[model samples]
Target: MINNRYDFIMLFDVENGNPNGDPDAGNTPRIDAESGYGYITDVCLKRKIRNYVELVKEGEKGYRILIKADRALNSKFDEAYEAENLKKGQKGKNTDDVNKAREYMCKNYFDVRAFGAVMSTGDNPCGIVRGPVQINFSRSISPINIQDVTITRQARTTGDRMETGSTEMGKKSIIPYALYRAEGYVSAALANKVTDLSEGDLELLWTAIINMFEEDHSAARGKMCMRKLIVFKHDNVLGNCPSHILFDKIKVKEVSAPPRCFSDYSITIDADLPSGVELIEKI
Candidate 1:
């Protein structure tokens, strides 16, 4: 089980792609209204991490993802209650039954262990778990330009086409390039509350963070890579210092022009760390 406090800064870049699009804005890239910097939500990054873990650890014991596509979440809660034979309409067993079900889910699901979940909904009310790991929204260093393009399909998909040479039109949005940074923290104390977060899981988390974009390519996201990962491990479980102070040590210089690639800027870590903290570069 984890015993130390951990904080990390993750750097990544995308080229000719939409790292995360805002569906509310015609599927364009999300941006900060004031600063004009590109925005990638924490949920988007977490989703990719979940996807990567699901891919590599498929069918492994206690490695299921809690929030998956097209799957009924209520069914999962029912399964948890069923594991302990807690029946529907059963009363007075909620206290023990909920705790058991919550523990079972935390032990079984990676996302639930790492990101927490609200399992009190539906038939069985599994108590909520506060996950140990928490990540911030990623924002690009510079403002990005959105490239919008329209393309046409020669043949229409509908069979009720009246014209002989009918074509369907579609729009695609992309950013020329952008480099983003996101921060996170992990609490050992919180992790041990429900699930046993082993060192193997820590390693797997890093692996997923680095390789998350490799298999996640499509027409929208063209090329993406994990540029750097800097971690600060505190000797104390409660943490040696505030996260903002540790994150301030790692500095990235401004680029000459609009950054089109990772090499455009330089990254440095001037870590005069405290007595009990250790820095680890995992990328």
Candidate 2:
């Protein structure tokens, strides 16, 4: 089991693509209205990590993904109860049984162990778990410019349009270029006492983060890459210092105006670190 707390920073960039879309805004790239800075939701990143884990470790023991595509959540809750050989009880009355199922979930599902879950909605409800790892939303270093590109396709869904040979028009939202930074935390205390998150699981989490974008390729999200992963590992279960202090040591500055690529920005990491904190650069 892991014996130390961890704080990490992730640097990623997107070129000519929408990193994340705002469903409420005609599927445009998510942006801060006040600052005009682009941002990707934590849930978006978590989904990518989960997808990567599922892709690499499919059908592997203790690596199942609880929240996955095309699968009903309640069925998973039922599976938990069935696997534990326990029957579902009254919604709020089966504390012991719920905890047992929750343990089963944490043991079998990698996401539950890392990201936690609220399994209180279904008939066979497992208790909620506060996972060991948590990630914040990633935000760009500067305001970004969003472009709406019009696209045309010759093929059409309707047979009449096909006969007419008229092109179908579509719109795509894209960011010319943006470098985003995300912060995350891992609690050894929670890993040990709550989720049973082991050293192997921690390593898997890092691997997932570093390679999350590799298999997730499409025309909408073009040329996305993980630029850097800066990890601050503490000596003890409780961290040696505040996470903010450690995060402040890393600085991202744009070397050119209207930066169009990653080379136009300079990333600096301070060498002098706090006592008992070791910095590991996992790119």
Q: Rate the local accuracy (lDDT) of all candidates.
A: 0.87, 0.93
lDDT of 1 by residue, 1-283 (tens): 8889899999999999889989899879999988888989999999999999999999999899999885889889888888878765453256888888888898899999888988878868787888888999998888888998888878786777736568877788999989999999998888875667777788898889989998798878879899998999999778999989999999986565878888898888887987799999998
How do the residues 1-283 of candidate 2 rate in per-residue lDDT, one tens digit apiece? 8899999999999999998999999989999999999999999999999999999999999999998777889889998888888877566477888899989999999999999999887888988899889999999998999999999987689988788777888889999999999999999999999999999999999999999999998999989999999999999999999999999999999999899888999989898999999999998
How many residue pairs of model 2 clash at the backbone? 0
- Residue 186, candidate 2: Cα error in Å is 0.4
Of the candidates shown, which would achieve the greatest lDDT relative to the real structure?
Answer: 2
Against the true structure, candidate 1 reaches a TM-score of 0.95
Q: Which residue runs does candidate 2 get wrong by more than 4 Å?
A: none
Report clashes for each candidate as comma-separated counts: 0, 0
The TM-score leader among the candidates is 2
Query: What TM-score, over all chains together, does every model reach?
Result: 0.95, 0.97
- Model 1 pairs in collision: none
Worst 10 residues of 2 by lDDT: 86-95
